[model samples]
Target: MTVPATAAGRWASLWGLAIVPLLLLGAVLAYLVATGGGLKTLQGPPVEQLKVSRVTLPERGVIQVHLVNDGPQTVTVPQVMVDDAFWSFTAQPAGPIPRLGRATLTIPYPWVDGEAHKVALLTSLGTVFEAEIPVATLTPQPGRDLFVRFGLVGLYVGVVPVVLGMLWFPWMRRLSARAMNFILALTVGLLVYLAVGTYLDAQEFAAALPAFWQGTPAVLLIALLTLGVLLALGGKRQPEEAPLGLSYRIATGIGLHNLGEGLAIGAAFALGEAALGTFLILGFTLHNITEGLGIVAPVVRQKPRFIQFALLALIAGGPAILGTWLGGFAFNPVLATIFLAVGVGAIVQVVWEVGRLVARNTAALGAPLVGWSTLGGFTVGVALMYFTAFFVKF
Candidate 1:
């Protein structure tokens, strides 16, 4: 006879239905209470620190400034300067930037100095917020560029374990179906953490946009689009017959996740925070190992060739390189949210597939839904991420 879930295990299923909504409600309420219980609209000089959100070259003879308004009231900026040179916005911004919004200024610049330059903004009351412009690189030094990008963009340390694991994939195929299912479920747990964490990380960044155009909506839209794309791609194909394809799906999801990691690294580096960039790289590298295991878990049954495994790894890992390149040069909060949403959507699909596989295997063994082994495996998978997370923020 199959055993029933215990009191604690019974609560776990409901958690899936209840926790996110409760937390979201709590977050909304906390934000309201913390900000005087409602949105405040105003215009004046305010005593709040302004931050340089991003700086970009829009065109020749032009530099664009994006200022993040973390203040309670909207404030009018009277002037902005680059180093000792004065510049004016070509066109005035529509209105005072709302709280948690970003303001943009486009200034003409005739110089193309390769050296670092500082940009400053002055409010009506003479409050100044300044940030350094990233030094321009006119020519590419391949070796140095690769070193900086890889070391800081999250492609290093994780490779060691991932490589070793793939080397042992041949032996893994010998494991029984139950063993593979345990591993599959465990991988699902790891991705469970990833999907949730990825969305949470983008929340504040998404909040910087206008209230109507928030990250939540964008994420939902992108996730749905990603799912539609995946489903469309698999039109009329059975999951069982195309077992090798499952690995590709997993890799694609992991690739999307890694691309987000690259964005973090690139954004950090672009803003001149090398330490944060390095920390992000290290954390992502560790996750990359677990991601590799998640990708290869299907191979345990399919017995894919080494060439196939290598291609899957590249499929999953190559995006990190491209993401780093783009993120360092140009990043928009909206785009970042979309990238993360895509990853979340794809990973959720993978989790569903893995769960179905696990259910079929466990049903054969007469195990309960709350079987200790499966639960233990999942808990372990979730805990594994904590090791890297503790050492550095992901």
Candidate 2:
């Protein structure tokens, strides 16, 4: 028997609907891939072991050193040697190296003279990686200082996507469910990736804590596991009809999670951990964009009022400000870990919900597109993580 025109039309419509979001996702992925998957080049190991390749002194009193890392593992150099005199150096963390990576160290010097200087990377093992480089004799030039501060502020605001999502969700809602689902899947992947990544960072921080505070990890792990089980129970009880509602809950949980992420970033930067701060920022920025998508996914089922959508976005994002402040100023590792674990637990609960949604939606949409979207989403998260690790000076 031949299918009716109405049925055929409906099927065609469904297919058309699915294509749009997939296309948008493809475009975003393409952009990410083109930009080296948004990865930053890793800053090489400290200058302690290696010699300076070159040195230039700015007229205004800034010193720049080009250095190489020939170490087995990435190392951080908190100080550098100049003319047999050691100067406080801020070097980002170097990374997993099968063999080699290079990093440049920049320092501010008010005095100008052609000085023969030695650079060194001091390791915890009490060994020094040392190199000698020459600083050019240069005069100082007057320059404005506020540019750095202003530039940072602009960068911070630009990375935030929630405002844009709130503004656009009304229009985005006209798209089909398949399209929305694809976006939602991508969002889910991003969150899972971030949650895992942040949790690992928290563990690292815990490990780095003073030996006297070391017992906190075991206690935190147990508490987090217990919380995860309880949150999973709540997720299990969610009604199926309100799938979008479930998305809202997940987004809310993720928003809280992002707060912890902000705290990590702020604390790292405040503590003078430049390398760690850089990595955390890059990772969190990429993660935040997908998070913006998550906030919009549930409400996309029915085109929400712009104000309502924006409100949701704000609600989801509001915690970040508080988290950042707490992390930067409070500098409490234990508290940060607790929040990190809580966020991780909540996200784990949401991931289960997303998996169920994907399974149910695939039957109607066909496995091909859903599979592609799922893979694409996963790749996006993984690539972002790698890129964050690669570049962010960490």
Candidate 3:
């Protein structure tokens, strides 16, 4: 049960940096709330000016745009026009404009090329806002669309760590059996934390939903169904290398979680919340580092080929990039919940699989001891998750 020197120091430093500041921040926030200073800020967003921007979509004729309410008070967009021609907005701002939030409105115009378009926004506050929206010529770039759109947000935050971990597989495979077991145990700890955290996150979303279906049961069912899908995919009762199978399962779960993170980033930006988008990127980046270890740990004894390792990395990491794309332009709450469910199921299985692996490897007398030994790693994972999670809701 002795703690590894490296692991102990790492966790100690992380906890010190994470917990102390979080405590101080909590106290400060509490004091602010008590004094109603923070509450006043939440009353409304600063409404000073109105801003407009044209959104780029695949179709050139479609005029997609949005407005940001920069001032403190609320402004409603009743109607809009393009080039003196009445253009209907698909999704108009239904409610009052929040302090700094944006309202996306799509106006599908027969946009003429090489022509300037003027958009006149009619608001309820007796203000006529006129802005020129320039339509761009669409040049098709087939291969680089993803990188151009979502950029490296997903790769940096969710995938790069897995790539690096894959590179270190040689060293990982050289570790002693006991050390490998410890790593396996540590991976489980991380998954356990993620499984619990993801379920809580689901609850938060569900609570926000309509009162009709208490989301708890739905959430549990979604997770179990996803687990069933995984089981169905692996038709056999059991695999020869259970730990490796478990490794893939864990990687799948981590990928789904990372995708959720990417979704948060994309949705934030799509909603024109730059500050939140940046915070999501930074928070997920920290979370992904340890996640790479979790993805790689169980496969240490398998001596997987380079292509196999690459496939694992892709399985564990590619969804992050895809999620960013979906979140930015096509965020669907239903899909987000589905991914969360899949992640939960994967993690649930991993906790069990890892427990079995740890138990079977060690002598009967030492299984409990191994479990105890991994507590430090598990605590570290939870602590780190919290530290990053403080910034982003997920």
Candidate 4:
């Protein structure tokens, strides 16, 4: 039986309308799962067991200790004690240590001269594992500002989308293509910088592994890269575009990306790496704004109702809250790299489409306007880099 063209079109429309809400609901569910069923107690590992390897007071002001987990299961070392003295500790919970996977714990030491101290790991299970080690306190030499600066870099990168949105409104829709292209180029620059500057540096820190695990850094990097590619490329079936401006597929993808970015920020902060946390927060914040624009840009093209535009923004932003909470617990450089790469790919696709639009609209705006707008976009990116550098310093 041949259905009328009108009937076919209506059916397609109805299916498209039904899909968005379903996808949104799924996104919420996935977020809940990632965050451990939304239960506070279940947020961390059931048990945290560790074998203390070494402790060093690299500087008189602050002491740093590195722990190696030789445990069977995942553990969270919530606090550490030295000689029965309370010291602030930042536990990096990398989950399940896989029978021998190592994790590091950094703690601050306030007392300059204390008799040889005993270190203890206070787990959620209320169990204490203690190891006594001698402390050598030396004059504090400032570590390079690179650690803090990289975080700021993330922050500035995050502000771009919000700035652009505020400056360029509905009337500026005509300029969207050129603006997006500029944003894409800027994002590429930042990502490349982060990939080399931040990711490589972290790898270097991990490279000082014991002889038994000297090759772990390289092996882990490769494994993470492969996993990232697979996850980004291998996913569910595609969906039809909706009249409201986005398809279920794209919205869900963006939502997931935002959520992940939020987690990166939250986890960084939770680990007591304040500089890194600030940077990630700023970077993701700006990144989310751009994503919001991406969601609404196409819908704006369709001249949708204001209510629809607002709904789209909420969908993109909603996932960020989930991401922030999840990030507080999990911090994996390889995983972060994968998410960064996926974002780069999506931004590239958007830039290509925008370029086509710009080419088509050249006649509408003279060459000078296009040139100026592009330059303006690039400047915004540069400014972000500078701001990040300034704020994230040791």
- Residue pairs clashing, model 4: 48-75, 151-279, 154-283, 155-282, 155-283, 158-283, 158-286, 263-323, 263-327, 267-327
Summing lDDT over every window of 10 consecutive residues in candidate 1, give the lowest-scoring window: 134-143
Candidate 1 C-alpha lDDT tens digits along 266-353: 7666655677777777667665677777778776767677788788877787777767766676667767777778887888787777
- Which of the predicted structures, 1 or 4, would earn the higher lDDT when compared with the native? 1
lDDT per residue as tens, model 4, 1-394: 4569889999999999999899999999999878766686755645455655445555455555556655555556666777687687665554334445566666676644634566777765777877654433342233345334433433333333433443334653665655555553344333333333333333433443333344344544553554455446534323224324232223444544554555556555544456676666655554445444434444444555666545554454545555454444334444444444444344333333334444444445455535655556545644555455443333
lDDT of each: 0.70, 0.58, 0.70, 0.49
Q: Which parts of model 4 are misplaced by more than 4 Å?
A: 1-168, 171-261, 273-300, 306-308, 330-337, 363-394
TM-score for each of the candidates:
0.67, 0.52, 0.61, 0.41
Per-residue lDDT, model 4, residue 361, is 44
All-Cα superposition RMSD per candidate: 13.0, 21.7, 17.7, 16.2
Q: Distance (Å) between predicted and true CA of 357, model 3?
A: 0.6
Q: Over the stretch 1-394, how does candidate 2's per-residue lDDT look in tens digits?
A: 3679889999999999999999999999889767856554654433333433334454446666655544444445555666567676544334321224546666665544544555565555456765543334442222244234323422352226555544556665787767666766666676677667656756765653434345357536744784677565665573654555665666666666666666666655443454676776666565455466666666666655556655566556666656666555454555666666666666666776676666677666776644777777656755654564444334
Q: Model 4 lDDT vs. the true structure?
A: 0.49
Q: Could you tell me the TM-score of candidate 4?
A: 0.41
Tell me the spans in candidate 3 whose CA falls farther than 4 Å from its real position: 1-147, 207-216, 228-238, 364-371, 388-394
Clash pairs detected, candidate 1: none
TM-score of 1: 0.67
Q: Pick the winner on TM-score between candidates 1 and 3.
A: 1
Which parts of model 1 have CA positions greater than 4 angstroms off? 1-53, 56-64, 67-78, 81-154, 157-164, 210-212, 228-235
